[model samples]
Target chain A: MKRDLFIIMFISSILIFPMTVEEIFDKVDENMVYKNMKFTARMNILEYNENRELSMDIFMRDENNILIEILASSSGHTNRFMKKNDQMWLYIPNAGKAIRIKGHMLKEGFMGSDFSYEDMSENRKTNDLYNMELLSKDTLYIIKLTAKSSDAPYKMKMVYIKKDIFIPIREEIYSSSERLLKELIINEYKKIGEKYIPINILMYDKLKQNSRTEIVYEDIKMNAGIDDKYFQKSYFER
Target chain B: MKKIFLFLIIIPYIIFALRFSGEYNYNYYYYQSLNAYGENRVILNMNADKGIASFHLQGLGQFYIGGPKYIIPYPDNIPNYVIDNLPSYYQLSNSMKINTAYLSIYYLGFNLKFGKFPMKWGISQTYAPADIFSSTSPMDYSYIEEGILGFLGMYSFGDNTISFIYQDHTDYEQTKQGLLFENINNYFTASLFSAHFFNTRRIFNGFVFRTNTVEYLLSGFNIITDYWGPGIWIEIDYFADVEYWIQDSIADYSHYFLIAGVDYTFNDLLYTSLEYIYYSEGKTDGFTYNDILRRYLNDNFLISKHYLIPIIGINQGETISGEFAAMINANDLSSMIMTSLIYQPREYLSMDLNSSFVIGNLGKDFYGLPPIYTFQLKFYY
Candidate 1:
């Protein structure tokens, strides 16, 4: 009788630990957020039997500022994008001046890729912008997140998180009209120090025909003491 | 052609050692004038970068086919004044000139550059009062400013920068020195610039505020705001002690120019912008026709008291884009409309087709100008 009781208690503790939706989001944010990081990434865009590649260097500070520089491209090169707070600026080497990109332009695909500018610029804590609810719990924890504000790029997202590491493995993004717009699949994960990072990502645009983009991250350095000057506009002139 | 081939041969060696990229452009222009002419131009641009050092070079070749008698006039001697106003392309009836050649070095937080390069300033796209380094030509849509021969040094801090330029005009025995300070932020950017000219015969001898023979003290302020949905920009330029020759007499005056513009994008598919400009020193209804001509001869031409410009752009996809722009002269009711289409089949190759038309009554602004059509193919690697 005591063995059966112990078994029932063990099963109950495993199933009914009483984890809140907010706690799950907080755990995910804690595992994914970084103070400052620098990385080089390559994007491969595949569409209609054609493959295009672009390489870029990225620097991020806190959660609100980011600097992206295109290192090499088959097309024109030396393009830069800087995001500070809510404002974003693009500098084209030919124009030799930085132009402000308005909010509506954030939804457009970046450099003709499947990733939108908003997707590239989003560095905020997920809990700050999304309301989360537990959907199911199997080998992975499934959660549905809805944007807290209308200004968000996607209205809803269904995220599948690894139950052990609290890292997202897959996500489905929905448009404002509740239509599936894009699917993001995390292909590979690397554990650098204490953090688990998704190093390879595949994005598929459901609304488009035979269009997909793959991002591979390399030379990633976290907490590398990047200078604050890198986020300033004066550094963009080069 | 031999020199160009040799230069292309050296590019491969440089690419193996460092970062090297170049572009070749071929364009054809058709002008609808009384003497209707066609011009074909081929330009090559090469750039190399390694560590703290970089180099840029541009070469252009032009061939004129069936133009008016006056199109390529051969003179005994090319006047200094003509050379001063010559396009940076360095086109002469007999010889070709190197358009741009520059080398730059960066160390610490300072950048030092030498040789000839194109420098552009001011917030307005079309007419910028603060663009004292280059002149805008109404006949071409290329927007290629004449390169300046000079040495430039710049130092940048967090959000602030300071720059100094020493420009030399050896042929005219003159030099210009300028200092500029700028600060930039997420919402706004501002700058203050001052330039001094030496060896200008018309101005007071030593350290006079001038660019070339013209004496002027200039200051500009620009503000950009996005507190609202769309973005609004305001720019103002103040010119103090501007000297102009009126019927062989030099006169001094002060004036200010103001520009206000707003831009917006809808659904990430279309972009639109509207801008208005007001020039305090422009010829208005109060000035007679001869007075306008005198202003034109004084190096201030085609500037109206008021101007309105509207621009629209459509991005069909990654391969196609189109733009339409109209510049309206409020005083004379004249307007210039331009339509352009760009097709990019590959990442490094593109083709562009452009057409421009001018409409107004005779003797009015933009009316005497002829329509133009252009087709260009660009390849970059």
Candidate 2:
């Protein structure tokens, strides 16, 4: 009987010691967050009977500042978007000046893609914004997250994470009214240094019919030593 | 001639390190006045960019049929003195012309620019009192700003910057130098500009202020709490000992011009803005038609005593967008309304349909202007 009790206690400790949902999220954030990063990406926006592709170069500093520039396009013009803290600005080559953009504009589609400006702008830590719970244990760990604040882009999200990698494989975003808004599926991921990053992300807007945006990241470098000058509004012209 | 040769020599070096890009645009327009007229235009834009150096060149070719004699008004024969002093590269022709050619270099956190390029100052998008460099053509709806031949140097620090610009207009026997200081912070942004004109013996100074704030509950979004909010901007320009050609003589005066504007967006789908401008130097009364014409021709003063502008825009996802803008001359009770529809069938191709209507008494502001409808096809490479 004493041996049986010992085995049961050992099993209980084993269950209790496994990382909690909150801890798992923290781990994920730690792996993903960076001081600065630079990457080149191609966005393929697919709609019914049509497809559009654009190339962009992105520089991100800390978690609040981001600068994006459209690579040379057929139109012979370059457009830039910069987000510093709470302010966002857009610069068009012809406009000759950067125009301040409202925060609500962050909810709209980015350059006619499924990704909204808010989705691309802020890099909030999952553990800070959402309350996570383990939904199931299988080849992949399914987790359900409820937003802690109404300011979040989505009220609820269901994420499927790889058990060993601590990275999300798929996610479903729901609005406050409990309507499914978007679905993001990670098609491919590359191990860069010590972190796992999604190289190809396919996002679908559930409200839109026959539409999807595929973002493929290439030549991504973390801790890229980007200068602070890049975060300034004047840098938009550069 | 020496400057042209210097530019030519630098062109190959810029091209060697540059990546080239640009677009071709074609537009057709029909106008209804006493007689119907049609205008066709094609524009080519080229840009060559290296790491810290770049060049932009634009060429425009146009043809008109039917109504008006000229699609774009040609400057009445420039005085011989003005022509003789003009830059050799400056050319005026009947059909085609090079619209812009400029080179810019960025070195050691300092930006140096030369040639002809658009220089913008002020916070207001529609009417900027501090924008003393280039005067926008009242009749032109294309919003294609003409370049100013100048040199500019700028240095930036944190969220602030200081720039100096020296503009050369030898043809007019005038030169302008301006100093501008700008700062941006979390709550507000402001700019101060001061310009001195040598030939006119006038000094112009102005300041632009803008603030943006978000109202969490007022935005009416259930999930998104931080809406874009409302933006308010004001600009005021003060001229010291300005001279204006009125009736046939020069009138010297010191006055202030002001512009105030507000803009907001709804749920990121709709946008609306309103602006009011007060021109202190504008003619109040006792101005004859020929006097107005002469002042515009000789001194290039186009401001009215009071002006009101309203603009609205709607975006339907990524496929369609529409905009309506109106400029109302409050004093004369005249207005011009412009409406445009943009459709993107594909990622790199877009079609624009635009229309303009003028309303008021004949010979009044925007009253005698003809109605215009335009269709444009743009392709990006």
Candidate 3:
């Protein structure tokens, strides 16, 4: 019991001492809040017991955190989108029409993870649900997060060590049922401009199936002069 | 001790899920009447289905060419007797494009999804055209259309992935009437109904005097690589529903369903699945659309599709596959035999031939000849 207390204090010292959530936010440029960015990326899909396949793409993004258009390998099979608040629209090249999508059917698989449609959007914030408690320190700070609501997506998320010089090292999420569903492991990090964002993210879903996804970013330009019109409905049609 | 422990283990999880979860989807499908059996007919049908997974966009749209074709040849000739007619069968055009996109951060055990995808409601698996198992005739089924919107919550545990899906029930309600006609309105559709709002309208004023709200529950999990390891799936589903509508003089009610299945890969050349479902239709208020369509379509096509089912499928490499599904009931009057042969000519193109026959008085008479046959050609990128 005494040992347990010492361990807990040690964890607290690492997480609470250097960087608070507000401190991390303060470092970013306020003007960067809504700038659109463009990037080229190599996307890899790896499922349990499956081979890893690759897809290449050039993506357009807005500062508002919207994924605007994806030019997939040239041909018009590529798709585009416009997202604002609760409304979303898609442009299909073959159909020659753009349609609106709405309702609760959004819980299906995305690119093939247990991740649902709603899991991919930019909404809510970490402070909305979690009270992060520091756990340890080395180069990274380990934190323990408990949910504010019983129905919160995760009962607990053991976010890996967040280092001052790099993006998060690893993260483990548990269901209220206390089951581990997925793991995100970041192996490589590069300093882009002023911020050190994760250039590569590897996600593994535990439903024990052959479903995993890896996204590698390259030629990333953040807070470049991009227009909101780039995220407009017409942009998706283009 | 074991039973109490089990209860203790499950109760908290249930409580946790009940208090927190929500989703919305826009599911849409169009039916093209391709064949006709008796008097039911649709000359052309098309559909569009849209959805959000997590909160991103997902969609499937297609057009069809034929209609349902079922016909009974009556003795001698009786005027005004449409009992033996077949509906049109619509040859479906390949989906213009199936688009999937999302922007949620997915890492480790937690998935933050924000896109579109379908909810597992109606037992029909095809994006449109309904389940080949339940349709009165191929053409009688509705084609895929509509879409859903909402976010998704995903948890990855051990070797399993658990998903808590909450979507607005309104869109699911739009399919309730169609489900009633299809007789698939048991726990599956009923649970979808639990998420719907019902209202009574005045024709002249277009006023909704009252609106009813319902609750739906869905628990889905898939095990990929635990004990059995990758390329394998062992899942069991238990779902329930409750509906409350004051204007229709409807009382609150609920029902339950159970289904379990496993998918496994053998060697590098074959994949297979064995699934069993135990379903109860719950309280039937006599002649729902399900009953009417059942009798109408059965008389015209000699097919009966309501019952418990066990299914098996085999996938050989990437280009060839087959499936067989049989329905078992206390009375032989309701059994089914179905099989399909699929061959992939290329990575992007394939062909299939399928045959389905219900074991009614008519199908039993044919010992040497198969009752139904279907041919299909497909292309995809």
Candidate 4:
């Protein structure tokens, strides 16, 4: 009788898990659609030791998820790097010359930060890079993703999402070595342009370093037409 | 007359060009304290500087984008070009005077310069791999002395250019000689003098299917002669007594270094890079009058920091990254590794943090090198 009971419980768990996961994902996809929207995001970085804190502003739009503009404070002493399509340029006030960065040099540290030229870029395609599998349904849809890109920095990721809102609750980034490098949690969500989007994001690292980054969105506008000419690489040096 | 010529020749083009740009930046180890005998003061701070600028031609010329000039210090005891509208730290005193000029032109995919200008030739990540030969170094942030007064030129051949050059005079010296007892060698003879033949060539290729890599090679011959030496003030003698002689035993040196690196783009938002460097040793120049003065005045002061380095970095999307760098002695010196991470929320704001630790056996109770840690907050529009 005990063996029969265990078999019945296992079969029921498997049958219910897929049904709930599918229902949650269906709710999420209902909100995430291709549209034109404009939004602003703010983030704070806390460094280890007795170092100071850092902040940033991010502006994003989804035009077929094609173009994105990221204007960051380069450093305290200079202001520069407005470019598109992975090309970047920097203008130093003191030198009086605008520098053009080509190829891999753009991948370098942005002011000694972990963020790179690619990090501050417009790349949003979860399905393209990951082989997704529905794992379980707790309060949200839980999915496990395995990277398809062999050269990817992370090997695998587990994402937690809200069933009703269809927004991610948390994501853990791992190294190829499977060591947990960073964990990102969405602390707050705001409804904008008929969709629930993350308004506040917090990033923490597993390394015993006293560094954390918080991103807060203040003013968000969506689907305003912006000229394509503004996103050109030539605009960076100009 | 020269100053007016400079304004007429150099200022026109800079004023005419226009641009618009922005950047996301972070700096780790903004400030790390050193543990010492007394209350550990801010002995040294993690000095990280990052920023971005965009420019718009307004239908003027072609558009260019890249990193800006991060370090440009004002002239004090050092001598170089002065931007009239910008701030300056040094002013002419009653006892000293400084004058300098350089003609630089960047056009037609080439950067050419004649007269005094800044030029770097070497392979190094921390200390220059070709320390003995490379003129510009990481430590020389002020860019004061590296701008040799000579004919310097760089051309991009098929998107890049490599060439050989020769020059005289590493530092400007008085054209006239000083006299002792109303009769001595002329001031021009007392000036600093050096000569060199340098060859440098770099090629950037492999932009196919979103993967790019660049390779560079640098070689040079550096010769220094007739440097400033300490002398005794002889009220009665007719010639300045050369006491601390540096000229007689100085040897001309030759050095070479190579740098190779590749940057691969896995996708629009992910990138990775790896680099390798090699160096050959050569001769180093004389110590400054300050060094000799410190030795006589007190017994302890740093003379110089010279070493070799290797660096690596990786980036994921717009908010996460990692950088690992190490500098070690050519042969036996223990290595120093520094790693950092950065986070940017938006265009106008960002943050950075980094940690540095030592590897292997470092002699002494505590390594002269302290662990590096820092944080930086940035604001730019």
| Position A149, candidate 2: lDDT | 65
Writing each residue's lDDT as its tens digit, candidate 4 over B1-381 gives 345435533553364332233232232222134221111111110112212212111111111122222222222222222133333322211121121234444444333444333333322224333332233433221222233334434433321233323344432221111111111121111111122222221211222112111111222222111112111111010111122122332332233334444444443344444443443331122433323223222222122233344555565544566676665533445455677677765435667676666553423111333454656555443
Q: For candidate 4 chain A, which ten residues in a row score worst on lDDT?
A: A229-238
Cα lDDT tens digits, model 4, A32-95, are 4334445455445555532323343333334222333333332333234443322344553323
Best by lDDT: 1
lDDT of each: 0.70, 0.68, 0.41, 0.40
Misplaced by over 4 Å in model 3 are A1-35, A48-65, A73-77, A88-107, A113-120, A123-125, A149-155, B1-78, B81-139, B142-381
DockQ, candidate 4, comes to: 0.03
> Which residue pairs collide, candidate 2?
A74-B380, A74-B381, A75-B380, A75-B381, A76-B22, A103-B228, A104-B228
lDDT of 3 by residue, A1-238 (tens): 9999999998898668856753433332231232355656655665445443433333335322355344332111344554443344455533333543322223333333344434444334555556677677565667777888532446688876555453567879776676886787877767666666666777777754566777787767776655443443223332
lDDT, candidate 3, equals 0.41
Segments of candidate 4 deviating more than 4 angstroms: A1-38, A48-122, A151-153, A228-230, B1-381
User: Which candidate ranks first by TM-score, i.e. highest?
Assistant: 1
TM-score of chain A of 3: 0.69
The stretch of ten residues in a row with the least summed lDDT in candidate 1 chain B is B201-210
Residue A171 of model 3 has an lDDT of 78
- For candidate 3 chain B, the 10 contiguous residues with the lowest summed lDDT are B180-189
Tens digits of per-residue lDDT for model 3, B1-381: 234333433443343221111112121222122232211111111111122211223334444344423333221222232322323233333344423323334444454433333333333221111121122333232333333334445544332334444433345553221111111111111111222222222111122223334443333332222233322223333333434333343543333333444444443224444444433443222222223233343322222222344455565433467877665432333455767788864433567676665553422211112255556555443
Number of the candidate with higher lDDT, 2 or 4: 2
lDDT (10s digit) by residue, model 2, range A46-88: 8785777778988988777888888764344567888876677
